[model samples]
Target: MGILSRASYVIRSKVNAVLNRSEDPTETLDYSYEQLRDELQDVKQGIADLTTQKKRLQIQKRRLEENVEKHNDQARQAVEQDRDDLARQALEKKKQKMSQIEELEGQISQLQRQQDQLVEQKDELQRQIEQFRTKKETMKARHEAAKASARVNEAMTGAGDEMEDVSRAIERAEERTEDMEARAQAMDELRENGALENQLDDRSSLEKELDAVQQDGEVDAELDTLKSEMGKEEEPTANGGDEAAETELEQELEDDTVSDVEVDDSEVEAELDELKDEE
Candidate 1:
């Protein structure tokens, strides 16, 4: 993906992850109350509608009964006026009205039954909504208390341990200080014995001496010539220059070149031997 798209995706993913981890019992309670309220409203509306339907059926039945009475009066008037045909027609109209009234009564009875059922349903739904409200409140309280307890536990277990960390840091600092003091005392003893600095200086002096000796290789060769000449029965050719070089090399080798350092194991042993002889 492009950088912008990837960035957007990561941001959205993190936001969703955080939201998913968070819990909102109050919101859930509110949502449940809203849903129950809606259902309760529907139930009430249904009861009202059924009641209205029952009333309309009653009005229609009343109107049909009034029409039948009016038809009976007309039939009686036609018989009194010596008009049998007119009376029969009025009587027939009255019969038709009676049939219609019967049909309307049946519809009214059915509508009354429906209205009763709606009333019962509305009452039950109201009770359910009330129960739901009580449960939602309980759950909200429990969730709040649980969250408070978790915060308290975190403070006690996590933040409280900082005091212990400070104490441990002080202990470590004291240990380091004691170690440094011991090391300083040891270094002071080494300085009093003139061993610490002299040990480093002597090594450098020895290396310089070895370098000079290697450079005067001809002097060493002449020393071998002198020894060989002195051992032979006859005298060998000797030069003044060679004699001077050998003499200078020997004098330089004999000079005290080592630094004033503590002696080695063999020197200490030789000193102890001399002390024993003196005793």
Candidate 2:
């Protein structure tokens, strides 16, 4: 049983391999339909040839039969006249002609059988081609649908990446805005607690120093004494000789002699007389 089964499996495998090599069912179906059409044409030609041959054979057969009938009639006449040799020759020719007619009839029958078989095969192949065409269309539609689904999934996934990036960007912007808001609130609180006022006093001190920088020391001191108390420093003078010495030193530096002119009572009287005259 196993050997038989293995033989049958081998036969099926060979048939399947041959079928696979011959053509792809989808492609073969199309080519088979074309070949079937050609085969049908060949069948038509074969039928026509067979029909013509059959007609020719029938005509020949009929002519041979008529000859045989005429020969029989002649043979009957010959026999009535007592000539047996001519009648015997006529019967022999008739037998040979009948054999040829039978041969022609057999050939026609064989050709007709082959033509019918070809026509049946053509029809069956055409039906299979149509079935394969429908299946191919379904397969093509499935492929297109799968591709479209993949594209849709890819587009959705790409959009998800963009949405993630946009979400992160929005989160960063919100964080920056919150940080700025917090800083502004801190500044406001500092102002409310007099810390900002203390900074203003520091600025006022800088302005006062700037104003005092361009003034003379006494002026700065007077302004400072207004802010505080004033203190005085003492100095010393030598004597009454200091004034006479300073006058003599001044006349000597100027190269003028004090005794260059006589100081007389008459000159004093003259200066007094002039003063009296002017009065």
- Please, what are the lDDT tens digits per residue for candidate 2 over residues 17-134? 9988775444554575577567666766766676677677667767877876776677777688777887777677777777776876787677667667766776776676677667
Error of 2 at 49 (Å): 5.7
Model 1 reaches what TM-score against the true structure? 0.50
lDDT of 2: 0.71
Q: What is the lDDT of residue 114 in candidate 1?
A: 83
Over 4 Å off, model 2: 1-67, 80-82, 147-279
Clashes of 1: 0
- For 4-63, candidate 1 gives per-residue lDDT tens digits of 999999999999889878847689788989998998898788878878887887888888
Error of 1 at 105 (Å): 1.3
lDDT of 1: 0.84
Query: Which prediction has the highest TM-score against the true structure?
Result: 1
